[model samples]
Target: MAKGKLVGKKLILLGERDGIPGPVMEACLKDSGADIVFSVTECFV
Candidate 1:
């Protein structure tokens, strides 16, 4: 992965069930050098 803009930043990822999921986003950012405070996937009707 290329250098991430989130390097050394803290984040909270909120994902949607119909969209990108939280865990998936986390995986993408795992190597971004950011501290993920939390990740959640919310479902909507």
Candidate 2:
């Protein structure tokens, strides 16, 4: 398995209810070994 390059890096994801990166972001998280920490989303108002 390829070791994560961001093992100690911090990651944050901010998305809208209809964001464009939902799937891609998920894939990144799955492949990441970094401390995948927090996520926040807000509805378009």
Candidate 3:
């Protein structure tokens, strides 16, 4: 597994679902070892 240091950074993921990430997006972020601070989804508009 690839690993890196993420001490004080913010990650904002905006999508259509909650607690579920898209495959491609997940893979890219996983490779970078980012610390996800926020994950949000839009319900309408």
* Per-model CA lDDT versus the true structure: 0.92, 0.65, 0.56
lDDT measured at residue 34 in model 1 versus the true structure, 0 to 100: 91
- What would the per-residue lDDT of candidate 1 be over residues 1-45, giving only the tens digit for each residue? 447688889999999999999999999889888999999999977
Residue pairs in candidate 1 whose N, alpha carbon or C atoms collide under 3 angstroms: none
Q: What is the lDDT of residue 31 in candidate 2?
A: 63
By lDDT, who's the top model here? 1
Which rank order by lDDT, best down to worst? 1, 2, 3
Over the full model, what C-alpha lDDT does candidate 2 score relative to the true structure? 0.65
Cα lDDT tens digits, model 3, 1-45, are 545674345567765555455443545675565766566556543
What is the clash count of model 1? 0
Q: Which ten residues in a row have the lowest lDDT in candidate 1?
A: 1-10
Residue 29 lDDT, candidate 2, scale 0-100: 76
In order of appearance, the predictions have TM-scores of 0.82, 0.51, 0.41
TM-score of 1: 0.82
Q: Which whole-number lDDT from 0 to 100 does residue 30 have in model 1?
A: 91
